[model samples]
Target: MHRGREAPICTRMSHPLVFDRALLRARQARALALGPEPFLLERATEDLSERLLTVKRRFETAVDLGTPTDLLSRALAGHPGIGTLMRAAPLAAGLAASERTIVADEEALPFANGSLDLVVSALALQMVNDLPGAFAQVRRALKPDGLFLAALIGGGSLAELREAFAIAESETTGGVSPRVAPFADVRDMGGLLQRAGFALPVTDVDRVVVRYGSPFTLMNELRRMGAGNVLAERRRVPLRRATLLRAAEIYAERFSDADGRVRATFEIVWLSGWVPHESQQKPLRPGSAKMRLADALGTTEKPAGETP
Candidate 1:
């Protein structure tokens, strides 16, 4: 058995605040007003729905956590397995016109302990300053054996654009500034789930490569998707026109294809875990198996350092 004091479930105090969440919310609201792009949300909701279909049990109470759009809520609506679907977002402008909609922050869920049967989030959580704390809150809100599913933008999502911006800024102004938000890596997500006291955690990546006419088109779409840079340490001054032009040139030169189209990669990291329960499957304890590996394979066993 492990010794020493157990760690705290919420680690907000340990993590540094990264994103300007208020600015992110404002940008999201502005994007909504300017006819926000819904393609990424649509793809995420469809994938989440497909994953939910594979689950054998139904969820009586489910919440769509912090999704800026109603795509997830609408997708889950009228589903045979979903009884009552609620939507929550950090801003009122992001909430849909539903009776169950609520303004709630992802970092601090409002649900009581063991209250929710299912919690699903799409295209959110990545922007949260305290992801570990948010995940712990989700685990706390779930009942035993309850499910949590989420899809967030992950590392490698904006590699081309990030590189272009860095190179162009350095070449034009002799310095680089924070122009893109950092994303979580897939390898760390499973450990995060385990740290949050989840059982049978699983994490996977789905890379979506979208081809655009030019770098400017991709940038415009990113703004429309409310994914513009909101890093707390971002440079306060406006990006220079010369730097922007140089960035475009760098992007076209490095990431363009034979047809002159540029590729924008979006790495969606899917995470799923269940609240720990006696009913859930557990790994067999060491030396508890009835049959040996040699017996199972019908092969003669040999001692270590022994030669036949």
Candidate 2:
């Protein structure tokens, strides 16, 4: 939790985790209805494609867990390495489904254990109310040595915009409301992967700095990306025009570069893990080494717990 920031009431154990699942579905529906452009999803899928290209192995079957947009599906559709590609939507929002698309909740996947060869998600997992539950479902759906890869917004994403909103609300309304969702830290995500039984877990980040004319453009892109404020504890009323104006001003004042455009940081956290199999390499056990490091490096080594 951030200092001077109280946990949202909906997050309390006595109450439910305040993510409005329906609101999330509605936002995606609205975004698809309003704009056909998919900037954020395209960029994220591009990164995912790079990772996919690195694998020398092939998959007989693969699943794209969340279908916020068709970017990922299009990328994988023609790949010769993957024999069958399927798409699943978290919500049944009347997203037209082909024979390949299905409506299944990530938290409660219907796939049988050890069924899939690969599972990949891009820019979708952050909004799930129960990440661990979702990950467990993914693990169960994968065959032994099956791979899981995903990329989502990290906790550091949109820091400038978050600060701008908080400061604007505090100055205009004398209090702040949740306008943005809290993203999971990378370390926490790695731990969750291990807890869900994913082996050889790997986590890294790709930080992107996008310059916008002002904060308004940033907010506009977020809507198109289906990344809206769906927090159950978010303010119910519409934001005051005065607050919006103040926020833009503060954003420009603090985050603008010499070019006069304000910058928004997008920290994309990438996760990779695989199901354990005997074919996979294992780390050597302690005291099982065949050669000493000092002998290899030609340097005298000091024993542990002793001064150099």
Candidate 3:
């Protein structure tokens, strides 16, 4: 049995690493759904759900994990991907004309065991402290041969930001600041799926290079995109002006391109797997062709029921 380290979450199981609230908050506030919540995190989550609906319609029966936004549900209702209308305009009109249902929450999915045909989540699983537990639950929620697909930021994400912070802190304070928590490695993620009883687990990575005039611009974009760091013991105060300057200088020295814009690398790890099923199981049949025990070893082939 694969026993993961106990995380500090106050529920059924804790994750090995502390989950970052900032990152969770950012995810929550995203535009998964529509509307302006005073909280940015809330809006982000809404946005996330909206985007997920686009993927959800692909499955025979799909369930989204996390909060859903009204705007997203509204958008989903009108999305032509569901085959609701022929023309885009007609689809938009039909969507605008219908009410939609959006379910929110991942930890406690609202589905019976082995009921889901497919499950897809985007950029959300890492935030869950008890990833193994979550994976187990997901496995149980899927039908035999059902598929699970997810996109998440991995350890290689934000390399430039991490490097800049590391260099600046080392030069200024002789210590590295803990502003961000590292993401899961590709190998680790694949193992997680397998350990959770998922079959044929596969993990692939996609590298994205984003350009920014300055580090601050990049940071601001990250914040807007709800992709900010969210380690549990992250620094509460803003970085000092001098420290920020040094960080920027370090970033330029190490990561700047000839075009004078800084490059930030994001590693998006795509994971996929299937739930195992008894119907797919195979057993060794009687009278099946078998390798001769002695002939392969240069000894005389044994007759039936005879020792070599």
Q: Compared with the true structure, what per-residue lDDT tens digits does model 3 show for residues 16-105?
A: 667665456545465223223323223433444454455433444554344222332333343443332111111211123332223334
Judged by TM-score relative to the true structure, which candidate is superior, 1 or 3?
Answer: 1
Candidate 3, position 180, lDDT: 60
Candidate 1 — which residues are off by over 4 angstroms?
A: 1-12
Best-first order by TM-score:
1, 2, 3
How would you encode candidate 1's per-residue C-alpha lDDT over 75-108 as one tens digit per residue? 8999888888888887633785557987888987
For each candidate in the order shown, give its overall lDDT on alpha carbons: 0.89, 0.83, 0.61
Please report the TM-score between candidate 1 and the true structure: 0.94
Location of the lowest summed lDDT over 10 successive residues in candidate 3: 85-94
Best by TM-score: 1
TM-score per prediction, in order, is: 0.94, 0.90, 0.68
Compute the lDDT for candidate 2.
0.83
Clashes of 3: 28
Tens-digit lDDT string for candidate 2 (78-188):
786788988887543334668888787665675767788999998888877888878877887788999999998899999998999999999999999998789889989
Candidate 1: the clashing residue pairs are none
Name every residue pair that clashes in candidate 2.
Answer: none
